[model samples]
Target: MSDKKYLVTGANSKLGKLVISFLLNEYQIKPSQLIATSRNPATLQSLADQGIETRAADYANKDSMVQAFKGVENLLLISMDAVGKRDELHTNAVQAAEEAGVKFIAYTSMPNPDASPVFFAFEHEATEKAIAQSRIPAWKILRNNWYFENLIDFYANVLHTKAWLTASGEGRHAQISRTDLALAAAAALVNSESGKETITLNGPESLTTSEMATLINQVLDISINVVHLSEEALEEQLESFQVPADAIIFATTMDRHLKENKSDGTSEAFEVLTGKKPQLFADWLQENKQSLKAISNA
Candidate 1:
């Protein structure tokens, strides 16, 4: 582990930032042992100030990845935030990693990427295939489920209006915190035991839309009713809020998939890897109450 070099792409992203922090502060890893790359290296000045290597690596540009990944023994290819171009970008990154002599690659992927009913699964599935074909010495696929933080907006809006709107019906999701997922990735990268394995990192418990609302109410001392809207109504509401067309379509489609139980999965995998139980939604909300309260008041 001492001899291996680690690189994390999308270093400016939430998961990437958290992973780097976990490795450096929690694991007491040296700054020289890690490399952080983003499309704009300027965004990573803080990491650079900490003595970590910061470089420019855009997933869409193979040359950038090749340069950023040079001598990197283990690489964490975070799935790009771009929706439509992910497959091409991921392929380019994997190819560049192969060219740069990266011995192992870890990919952040969605739950059941190959067969997920959700609209976002195709690109993840494609990225996984590319990694397999890259033929790096070893690889690990981290199929992370939804983040509990995703509901912050919903909770904020609900606290403001006393109503939580959703098209997802009673579908339940075992969503983990972004911090927990980051810790798990860091655990995998630092430990020598992880290789050629695929693990689903999920929250300790699953909760439905109404159940989640209840949890929020419990923590924040606010009661919000879950209003189940039809798909058309949900779309109309999102459009009224000026959400982009693509995002509206994706959210509605995911709601349909949720109704079919697409995300109803949970595991102890995170605990196994990090030696700590994943944060429960209620617990996370409690820890983050001040921010949520501020948002609610705003």
Candidate 2:
């Protein structure tokens, strides 16, 4: 393991970039000991400039994945972006990692994968199953909850339109910042003792949709109407707003899960991993207020 290198897939993604940055800057992992991979090598020029090994790895290409995993000791499989193709892609990655004799794997997954009624949970469950079947020496699953950044889109629209509409009637979500999740992931990867663990990462608090709107209003100093609609009504509203049908369906399903109280906000796994309290929604908003204001103005 000491002679092998750390490999991070999807190193160019927002969350992936944060994880890699934390691994380098905070964890003090040498760039020479790290390999950052993405579908496009050009996008990872900064990492290459930092002396990190860069590689091209397409999730769809089994050979590319196998080559990328070569000589890798530990791997962080940032969940694939290709939604529908995730299961097969994840399987290929697992196979490649095993073939490369990877000692440990840390995968980013969704919260409550087994119990989540949301349509998106299928891929996570399948990936977890594949990892278990692989009999990998060690594994850590970071089951991240909804990101606070997800609210940027709806909150921006609400600030402009003066109205926030959702299909999640009385639904509550425990949304954490992606950066915090990334920190937790990096901490887990760096801690040699944290192996074969499955953790649910969420915010310090769970908030209802209406509560979220109130918080947004408080932070932005604006009044925005928060309206909850039936699933069908929300679908129609989203369609009218030009959202794609598949996205609308997925959103509605997630909203339904929230309404059913499927989310567990009791997880302190993030704090345990990172040795710090996760950032709150208000602080996250305050930090990004400038960008949010710009979007509102636009």
Candidate 3:
């Protein structure tokens, strides 16, 4: 058993769970050395059953965070699910970790947090700043790109309407898989050599919105068209889809950033950290083709 203890906040979340699974299954880290935390401990019963410590650590509850971090040597502060309350919640987590004397903190942040037009980037930047001022011995910031899972949100529309809409305006994205990012986080946490680092995790290749749509169609054996709209038009279209107004605003803002080429870059950071190339979009689509069919049929 490793002497160090790891606490993963939001351990029940999709990315968080993947990170925990990778840490245990891939790295061969002992269950006793890991602590999985969620707002509801019931959601993490499996981890508890496996001999991993589980705790109900709500970001809004400082005392719960404090208790969760007690004796923890490293912390993986997965960003909170609650969108608006992220800054406050993250701040509380940092404070608790500092209070607990955690030696290192690995934060899941977003791409180009300092200049990202994405509203969520602001929260990540704030969290990074908080971690910097917390007096922790070490910190690693994983600025992840858009997850491949996000493609599913537009999958149905692309299948049915044979069209994909975007405000990106031909801008490219170096999309990376959530699993890949999770694995990188696990490797960084487990490796004592990482020290304090800020890594931008991205896919091996960058592709434009239209190019991505083409790849998806090719992999699914379907025909689809890419529709690029101005930011204003995209907002109106999103509203028509019943997307919340604030969400539309945020999406448009991110689109503007993409248009300015703020999110595009070929980074080997993922491979460097995990010692393997990040999975490509077409390959992921081919692997999950059946699931896409099921969702489209349903």
- Which candidate leads in TM-score? 3
- Candidate 3 per-residue C-alpha lDDT over 1-298 given as tens digits, one digit per residue, 9 for 90 to 100: 6578988888999898899999999999899899999889899998899999998898899998888899999889999866887888899999999998899999998888889788777889989899988889898988888888876763465666777777888787898888888898898888745667888899878888788878877888777787889988988888899988887777788788777777788767887788899998989888889987666555
What lDDT would each prediction earn against the true structure?
A: 0.85, 0.84, 0.85
Model 3 steric clash pairs: none
Question: Candidate 2: lDDT over CA atoms?
Answer: 0.84
Clashes of each: 0, 0, 0
RMSD of 3: 1.6
Q: How does each model score on TM-score?
A: 0.93, 0.94, 0.95
Candidate 3 TM-score, true structure as reference: 0.95
lDDT of 2 by residue, 1-298 (tens): 2545889999999998999999889988888899999999999999999999999988778789888888888899999866787988888888888887888999999878888878878899999889988967899988888888876753457667878777777766788999998898888777745558888898988898888778888998877797889888988888898988887777788888888767647548888888888898899989988887776667
- Model 2 TM-score? 0.94
Model 1 stretches with alpha carbons more than 4 Å out: 153-156, 236-243
